[model samples]
Target: MVTTPLAGPTDRPAPGRRRPVPRRRPSARARRRSAPLTLLTGLVLVYTLLPLVWLVINATKTQDGLFRSRGLGLDRDFALFDNIARTFTYSDGAYTRWLLNTLLYVVVGAGGATLLAALAGYGLAKFDFPGRRAVFAVVLGAVAVPGTALAVPTFLMFSRLGLTNTPWAIIVPSLVSPFGLYLMWTFARDAVPAEMLESARVDGAGELRTFFSVALPLLAPGTVTVLLFNVVATWNNYFLPLIMLKDPDWYPLTLGLDAWNKQAATAGGEAVFNLVITGSLLTIIPLIAVFLLLQRYWQSGLAAGSVKE
Candidate 1:
């Protein structure tokens, strides 16, 4: 008994059981190291949300409330519905016309741009031909050039061709997306392997048939990315439409909204600031919807070739 106390049943560990391991806590030093990064991320999040918050808060107020309330503060009137009604009914339902015009541009201009980009990009990537390097260099140079720099020249060219002030003025130019073409070219290079195209060809599939049947599915992600980019660019296009179109009926929402903003400067023009804010909010909703709908595809597209043997 003096040598060792008898082991009690309670003191014995359960048979075949192991001790539970405690979760390792981060060291104080590790937390300190992450603090700056966390703080920076929070600040960036706040900065991004601030303007949107301001837009939402201000969009709810009436014309008089806009001038009366603080930038981010809401008014009690809740004129959002009234503002929307007035915005559409203003000037022979101009806002509705602008909305339709924007949809048309997005559908035709962006859609055409994506199609052309896909065809050209797929061709450039898969085909072997002369002057390919030259074409690549030209595309790169075009991408480097700012669209605004070309707006005046494009206007002049379209004017001479009698294409200005028409839908073609906007649509034709939107179809030639240098960045989109380049994006597709690169994406097609990696996404659709030459082996698959070769296999398709061996199966007696024609080039167009092979593209539509074999390669197009693989190119979905890239196509969607290019489509989104072109959609945003064409939908928000202002300077081009401004110089290209003079008719109010043809105006896209961007130009139309700007007109509403500047209307007060025109003689006998009453200010519709509340409507502008509400319309601005409405204008962005579709873009947000598009982004939300396509974001997963874009992400998958990005991760397409990330892992390889």
Candidate 2:
């Protein structure tokens, strides 16, 4: 009569049931190990951002202020707008010409490289063609060879073909991206399902149709990644264009900026330093814009590519 009521279902575990165990916090040793890594990462970030911060501060200064003020500090005169205007207007708007040329090279060269990488990577992943392994081997080998090492040889080859001093000299060399092809191949292998390809084929779809309609949607992130890499590479390319192009009209932004820097260093050319700084800032803005705009696609592609059917 005095016995307690039976325990409610929610109050305690049923017979033979065990209570859930709480997760243990990481030990002190783990926290100690992570501290150094955190400090190292902070240092690396500072090292990387220091130059960019300096550039921004200097871009806001006058030509004389660049020398008079601390390299990393702002000056009294904020000539950012004036510097930008002078940068674009100098030498009959030659900086504008170089900017346009860079756009052209990036659009045509990087775009072509991405397209080719996507197509080739898709083929390597899905098809069983002759010499596929050998092709991949060659790509791996090419990836190990630094681009700078190949620059002189490439220049000679292009020169022999009479393609030097032209846009083709830059565009043609940039169109081949071994790393892009390898990335696409890896992404395609994992992201695409054999069943999906079979389904498309059963529905009377041709290979190209199946790829474009079915596979391409899934390959979006990989494509965007390759596109961005090639675009940045082609956009910032310096030595290759320096060797290839003689005409100022054909110079890309990197070469143009170098020219401005050289002029600023010359005896009577000190006035162009601010223009050089501003032009450098302007050159980087488009790349930042591109990354921000395409980041969504890039993230989604990478995430999707990681999952399997």
Candidate 3:
């Protein structure tokens, strides 16, 4: 007999399949507790961004407007473009020279530092050698020492070798980043696999080839992290350059800007605070661009082995 089945409750879910769980709304007490945390987070955001806001606002103002205009508000005269032009053309293009110098330092110095740190760190992690623990201890000690403490000694050493007032003064010291080495060592220990290296060696690949082909790719995230740290440290380095360089032509942006800032204070100096402000703004743009460009690496996966059940 072809009998039609009766309809069941429309609201009931089918057997063996559960109904979707309903979400709970936060209680009033929970919301009330979260309110203070939300407020505090907002306050912290504002506090952190305040200085950057001030810099942006002031960078747009002309010298006269800088002194005369309201701090937080815009000036009637929009001279940001004019200021940028002047900033480049000022003092027979000293700013341009300083900019080039900074780029050179970062490219050669920071770049070298990152590369050495990676190779050394990877080696320290993967290689079995005598005195490896001692090397680790030394690196940790070096990391603990503040760079400022080394400035005087570095100056004295460079002075003896007649390397002061040269690019080497900046580049040489930047090449030895203990913190970068340590960071890479820690990262490599987990990010790269010993089994992979063994496989590569069994496949008749040379050490260098194995590193470049297998290990280096795995080390990219850690490498980028160390690179950024070195770049920032080398770029913003004030004390080392201050002590090492006396030539304005050799000066990095940090020292160059400081020189501009001191104009008003100097006995026979002109007040070019506007240029200082504008140049300061220019100095940080590359750093911001770098951070934005490389931020994607921070989220990507580390190295992994064969999938296991």
Candidate 4:
């Protein structure tokens, strides 16, 4: 108690001592460093958005207005609805057929691809089997090989099997996504715990039952990611369908739109230009909607897998 009483005012900060200054706003050097990054980000935004902006603006114009008006802005006469109507009704409603075909591809091809990727990835992550590493190496190599490179060989193989020009051609090629496999493999490795798998096994749950009931739930975000990627890929596929499909009836939206674009470029085919622009606009809307709707799952999956316990 006596020692405590002996403690002096000097033990406290001197009355004249300057309190620490609020961290001076980030140093000028840091601000200078950030300036280039800010500029680069702005440039990237403009670069990415410019095409979309042009597409939207052109989509609103009449066929005459499309060529007559400035390339980057609205025309005096807006005919967005008229263009959309013509897009759907043109050529015996072929656009509708293309749209339906695209949907079919997305649902069957992408959906199947996602399921297979999830199963394969989870299996690769959680199980041990002969040739597992070889399978993984082949997948990695496949990822490195551009789809364009395989297009010729795949077309030849399908041609021999007589699968070309059918929905099976597109669906078969889309069924295997090496990137998706790798993505799900990494995600499953982190998201599903060995302890949980062991517990499920100990409880007499079969592997398939445990996977579907327990592991699949935890893999939702990863599944969504794979599904969305495959959906977009299948929906927008051009070169594959362009080569495989000889019949216009079998054409997906991407190929059909290119056909329309080609037609528009020819003499006396100018009227179809507006339809092409409008159809292109319509094509991207579903994709945009999909991203907006599923962004939450995508973000959550990415965040969840970013850290490991």
lDDT (CA) for every model shown? Answer: 0.90, 0.91, 0.92, 0.90
Per-prediction TM-score to the true structure, in the order listed: 0.88, 0.90, 0.91, 0.87
Q: Which segments of candidate 4 are over 4 A away from where they belong? A: 1-25, 265-270, 299-309
Model 3 segments more than 4 A misplaced: 1-26, 305-309
Query: Which candidate leads in TM-score?
Result: 3
lDDT of 4 by residue, 68-186 (tens): 98999779998999899889999999999999999999999999999999999999999999999999999899899999999999999999999999999999999989999999999
lDDT for each residue of candidate 2 in 1-309, tens digit (9 for 90 to 100): 698888787988878989899999999998899999999999999999998898899999998898899898879999999888888898999999999999999999999999999999999999998999999999999989999999999999999999999999999999999999999999999788878899889999999999998888889989999999998999999999999999999999999999988985678875578888889999999999999999988645333443355
- Displacement of the residue 271 alpha carbon in candidate 3, Å: 0.5
- Give the lowest summed-lDDT range of ten residues in model 2: 299-308
Q: Kindly provide the TM-score of model 2 when superposed on the true structure, using C-alpha atoms.
A: 0.90
Error of 3 at 218 (Å): 1.1
lDDT of 3 at 46: 100
Which RMSD values do the candidates have, in order? Answer: 5.4, 3.2, 3.8, 4.9
Tell me the lDDT of model 3 at 220: 91
Model 2 lDDT at residue 9: 73
Displacement of the residue 305 alpha carbon in candidate 2, Å? 12
lDDT, candidate 1, 210-280, per-residue tens: 99987778888899999999999988899899999999989999999999999999999989988898999
> Pairs clashing in candidate 2?
none
Clash totals for all models, in order? 0, 0, 0, 0
